[model samples]
Target chain A: MRKFIWTLVIVAVVAVFGGRAWYLHKQAEQNKDAIKIGVVVPLSGFDENMTDRIVTTLKTATEELTKKKPYKIQYLFEDGKYTVKDSISAFNKLKASNPSAYIVLGDLPAFGLRPLINETKMPTIVLVSGDSGLPAQSPYLFRMSLSSKDMIQRLASFTYNTKHISDAAIMKIKNNYGDDGSQFFKKYFADLGGKVIAEETFNVMDMDVRAQVEKVLATNPNMILVWGFGPGYTTTFNQLSELGYKGEIITDFGVFDKAVWENIHNKGDGIYFTTIDSQANKMNPQFLQNYTAKFGDKPDVVASFAYAAVEALLKTIENPKGIEAGLYELQNFETAIGKINYDKEGEPHAQIVIKQMQPDGTAKIVKE
Target chain B: MTYVLHQLIMISIYLILVYATNLVTGLGGLMTMAQAAFYGMGAYVYALVALNMPVGFVASCGISLLVAGLVAWILSKVVLRFRGETFVLATLAFQMIVFTILDNWEGVTGGSYGLSEIPRPSLFGWEVSTVPEYVLLSVIVAALITGVFWVMLNSPFGLSVRAVRDNERAAESLRISPQKQLSRAFVISSVLASLAGCLFASYVTYIDPTSFSLTESIFILCILLVGGSGNIIGPFLGVLFMILFPEGLRFLGLPDESAANLREIVYGTILIVLMYYRPNGFKGIYSVK
Candidate 1:
């Protein structure tokens, strides 16, 4: 029995690795003529709805690009699962394909891949809203979407100048996203002489934020800044409503999701959040129409970013210079999201706007 | 080639982790869920020192090992008083506490934002920067750990620990101190785990609290359980299987939409089947209860 088991284990190991090697060779041969663009994103483990939207948008955009481009463009995706270790693993797997460029989603994967990107000098575009400093870490790294710093600065300025809010409380999720949002808002708001009277935090997995909401309400601030993503948004909004706190509530881009509004029901009404400027979306109505027609639903901000990333990559590839050079030279490049301009640091600047939730489960632009 | 080297590096690191874990859970009969905590501690210490102190990789690793071992020694004194399920729970609590500290101590740990720009490992005018170099360094460290563990586990101290694990009262009657042996085993296990952590930090160049969460500890424990722990070869086999099996599934050419989920399902199913067939693991002399 012992000898048989040892033989079985050895056979299994040999079969797995050997099969993988064969499969990789076949894949390489098949895609030999195509321009391979590797995509590393969370295909599992974190925010399935968002991943689904991003993947669908990439597929749609890629199909459109394939028809127009002179050469074949193939996208090979590896699931990063939105974690550092898995992101590194995913990038390593994709490295075997020798892609012309890479598209990495989220902040964690970008940070994890920064050193590798510097080493390999791969022209990679990261679609992220948090941590504006990421693109500075690597010359080959380019960013899409308005960074959290930009959006929060706009939001803080709007709050203090337009809304005349002097004091505020903050309720943020406990992860990096929440930390960035809270820290940025506090710094920007404090610079404008606004006082953050109270601050509280809850985990992303928390089903209840009554204690946190109540703690914030006890401070009796003029407004509150809620920063986080996922179910926590719904929970925070619902708890605030249950507690009968009627002060002005502002949030980050996370509340733009339909799921959050639906989950909070009417509780999210009158809440304000910062997101990409709607003027750009208005400028390109056909993208919204095509996405809705194709997917049978409207595209969220994340999907728009994904679509824009593909468009930007296609434009960069068309340039006479290489991807890295083309990325640095991009200015006023129009895409599905809006016109994009990459500074010398490879960080793209986009317009940010604030929107207010309505009782009908839709949001209206309040500030731009 | 880099991808292959990356996997080999990860396997080498996990080998150290599993071998260290075997000392406490496999040989000493103490199931610990705090390996990742010590692992995180080591990584954080190494990262902080390397980033701030301008120390070489060897000194950073030494400091990490020392800090992790000291914490493990203190924790062992408190947790070793309990037995079985209670001991496991105590270790779980420690893991949670460590995770919270790493997650909330934003000033030091960067909170959940994670520490980035960690310099690569260097020793005596040689900088290990490339993936191949990292792979070689990790393998050498793992080999040295294996040699030390091999000698230690074969010594009389190893026999005494096993004797205590099998029957603490009997070992005590025979003049062996259960507390002393178990504490030493636990501390040594943690110190080795920290070394693996140090290697991981330098190899990846980025780490966040999520990398060292409770899930990772469970994953490490699972590797030991699946491979059959009480001995060196058992955990070694477990490390290769647990690390490579999931990675191998990635190459099966599943559809992109369902591939990640499918890989997980298949991996879980295989684990269940393996455990069902071999309760004590393929080559393990002792089964974790």
Candidate 2:
């Protein structure tokens, strides 16, 4: 009796997994005619709101595109949870869906899937701001977001030339994004004859950055550059305000996250951030209005990039050339973020602009 | 087919890791929280050697094991002085120290940007580049490690370690050096973990500090706890349940918006219920005190 029960349990376990796999395989077969795009994004963990926006924007764009296009497009999303292991798992799970192309968010996911991308030779679009140079490593990999080098160049130029800031301190998250921002800002700022007086780092899970903030303030630099993502930025901003240092503050487009500004409240006002050009909004005037009306919230730069990825993929599908060749042939492709151009290295060159946060938790372009 | 291969490879790598954890925590009865650190050490060392040196995959893995073993030996010397929760805390501190080094050592480890473009494992002109090839390599490695562990555990050395685990005073009365045996188990456990790390780095061809965080250490410990420890079959059961079951949840076709969270919830709940019903795990002989 005991032996029979154990056998039954084992059979049941296999049946559950086998049943699900068969169901998904059948579904994939049924949708064989549709162009499947696998999207890996963080649906949990840090930056959930940001990924939620990406999903919403992708769905909205795909819905609109499918209605007008000749061929149907299908997007299958897998939750990467913004980590390397989960991203790889998500990618593998999405493979069962039989996607022709893939879209991975963040540097970690792109990096994790780099080897697999090479192995599979699937055309993948990576939406990442950090200048990790991953897109250049794989021919099939194309980057959709602005590079950190370009954004830091503009920020450094503005800090030195426009604002006349002679020295700055950096408080950055201790990851690829933070490392790139700090490294690039230092290099560009030094080239522009400005000095980085001090640098402090904190982990993403760190809730209190008072120690790091205190150290940065101790340097007494003319401007402070804060580079990070997620809710941690709010803590940094609030702590900076608590420290009561009267100096200029600057960050990246990550500051535009609603969770950050709303939590930081008025503390985020007067801070400048480098982001994709506001011309992106001007090019698609209806995007902001439509996104707001549908989602009941404003779309940030990340949403625009996500929407643009869908647009770029659609263009590739429409082209007579294949995914890889079509991607390279794309020139001045219209997207929510204005016109995007892909260089020979598969990295998209988009205009970057500096914007200042308003007291009402909105950003306005800094007029040069 | 490729996805199945990928999961198999991952399971193989994690099986080695769980075996490493099970050796010290299950048999030696010294709960460790630094498996991921040793794992990371193995990966980084393997990546560095592979990228910079002319060494092949075997040599890289050998060097990684040597380095991780040395660190584990040194760590064992310090952490072995403590017992129970204090020992666990010491191991946890070591984990944090290693993570900090990996995160901040920009010049060498590439810091948080991580070391990318890691070459696939090649042994004397035989490369494990393809997914199926990697699956085969990983499975062979996992099997060899399992065989070695079985031999080690069934030997007199294993009996002495278990004796010390059950009662250190009684084992010492029997002339079994508790400190020496435990240290050996710890070092051996860590070296095996580093081996898994090497396979993972070469397999993924990319690794960052985030891959070897404290969370991972806790997860490895959880695997041993849930699968049962202090025995050979326990680690295998733990690996299958801890790694594959959560992955199997992905196929449930849950709504995308809540799928990740839902999977986590269901997984967590099952673990809790399992522990509540079977405190020592499915096949565990010794539970952590």
Candidate 3:
């Protein structure tokens, strides 16, 4: 009977406490004047692992910004889990609660929300897909993140501006992304009176490109331009080695995957590509140190890009009169990625760097 | 801005998921984790077919139905032979396979990034332009689902499905081929799932692997269980409850990240509560869809 009474008392306390907890939760939920900046990310499955580095970056952004701007930037994180429908569903849900949705950060590529965005006029600060280089019909969408076109443009311009090479060959996937990047180079280099002796295209998913690389190498160009990320890049390097083709290589940012690098470690010596950020760079000790302490590992360019996006959004919403003025400030703010800025539509104009994988299997930017 | 429009829209989506999952689990009594696979198939097929095709709304739904039904027929025969846990595992395998196609077939389905900017159905010019209008579309779909489920599940034909669910041998001994009833349930579920998929693709304006996750399948199943499986109101309440309650938590002055995690924890806790007190799942009509 004594134990029973004690148990009954414990149960009563738990029940009362639980009831109070829920009531307070409900009461707090009803409060207005709480400004919310919605966020979406691919948080599970294949994209699940991608969120670890990004989540830390997100945590840091809010914590850091609150020190300066207090609680002005309210973070509402929605998990899109790399699904386009889920991302839109998350956005729709956010809009339902906070309907006058302002500055959002997520990978809202043009193709995903193009029709809806064109209709809604919601000021989305999207981590974008295509660039201004696409066909004119890509809409009035303002991307507050770097584009593949911009990255390639900087890669081509810097390589040529510093007179890095006069003759080079290009190899890429036969897709719009690679094809568009190639056209930019073709137009820019030809105008500059430089020689792009050979240009080749391979299937997008196919990683075996020995014949393709050899055909480009057969042109006897000064450097080989490879434009595939991940496994495709690894395959090109291995094939280039097997064919014993030893000239300079210029590729896009995608080839920097660790497994891809390891796959081509022996062959990646002196191979050149371009990237927005790097994990190995201990130069910016502040971010890397914080990132290391939290995650117990180095941060990837993907994570850095995500952080830069949140940081830009923070600066935008936390300004004197909010987004419009914040966007004005964001357009010119400089960072580790260069003088980062956006046009009126919130698309970022960034100066990309060309990084070379040295003989020792580490990457270094070509300081132009 | 009251999102009565958005809530109605969500009602339509989970309504389809509920009846479809009901057909396999509620009626056919197959605890499928692969309904998400069919839903995804329906989504991708709808997007791909509608891209260059001149198919209108009903036609788009029809195509999705046929495609998903065919896939379901194949899967049901191959995987339904196993009992209980093996069946669930088979469906899980199917879900993973569909996810693989969505993520790896980048050129066709745009890979893991997915096919985006799917145009809204411009069916003969009365545009389903807004979310409210889409909500109406969803209501019609739900009505169709209710009518169809009513006819099939209440009919003697549905009894055979229920009969198979309770005891396959008993249904078989009664001259009702368990295989035949199971096949019909699979087709019906797939068609319903495909319709939802088509609507989902049209409403969301994009389709990717994320839409077809095992978690999504489980979420839909939770809707079935929480709202009391086999009842129409159960799914709606489950969906509405799941979507609104967590979002409502934003009012409290916690940091953004804490609020987000708390929302997830609350969702988990709600499930645990429903499980502990109401395992037959509140409505107790537990005979599967």
Q: Which structure is stronger by DockQ: 2 or 3?
A: 2
The candidate, 1 or 2, that scores higher on lDDT is 2
A1-368 per-residue lDDT for model 2 (tens digits): 99999999999978976887788789768777888889999888776777778887787767766676678777899888888888888888788777889998888888888887887799999885576476788899999898877788889999999999989999888788888889999999999999999999876767899998998898888899998876566788889899987899988888887777678887889999988763444424455566788667666788878878877888888777788789898788777677788888888888778899998887889976
lDDT of 3 by residue, B1-289 (tens): 3245665676777788888888888777788888788888888888888886877766776787898988888877888788688888888898888877776687788764577667676666778877767877788878888788878867988988888988888888999998888888888887788788888888877676766878788888877777666545566566666666654544333343344455567667977987789776756477343
Candidate 1: segments with Cα more than 4 A from true spot: A1-30, A278-290
Higher-scoring candidate on DockQ, 1 or 3: 1
Scored by TM-score, the top model is 2
What CAPRI class is candidate 2?
Answer: medium
Each prediction's whole-model lDDT (CA): 0.85, 0.87, 0.67
| Counted clashes in each candidate structure | 0, 0, 13
Question: Which pairs in model 1 have colliding backbones?
Answer: none
On lDDT, the candidate that comes out on top is: 2
Q: Which candidate is the best by DockQ?
A: 2
Residue A164 displacement in candidate 2 (angstroms): 1.0
Interface C-alpha root-mean-square deviation, candidates in order: 3.2, 2.9, 6.1
Q: Which stretch of 10 consecutive residues in model 1 chain B shows the poorest summed lDDT?
A: B249-258
Q: Kindly list the per-residue Cα lDDT of model 1 for residues B1-289, writing each as its tens digit.
A: 8888988999999999998899999989989999899999999999999999987999999999999999999999899999999999999999999999999898899888789878899889988988888888999989999998888888988989999999999999999999999999999999999999999999998999999999999999999998998888888889899988988888877777888888889998999999999988878999899
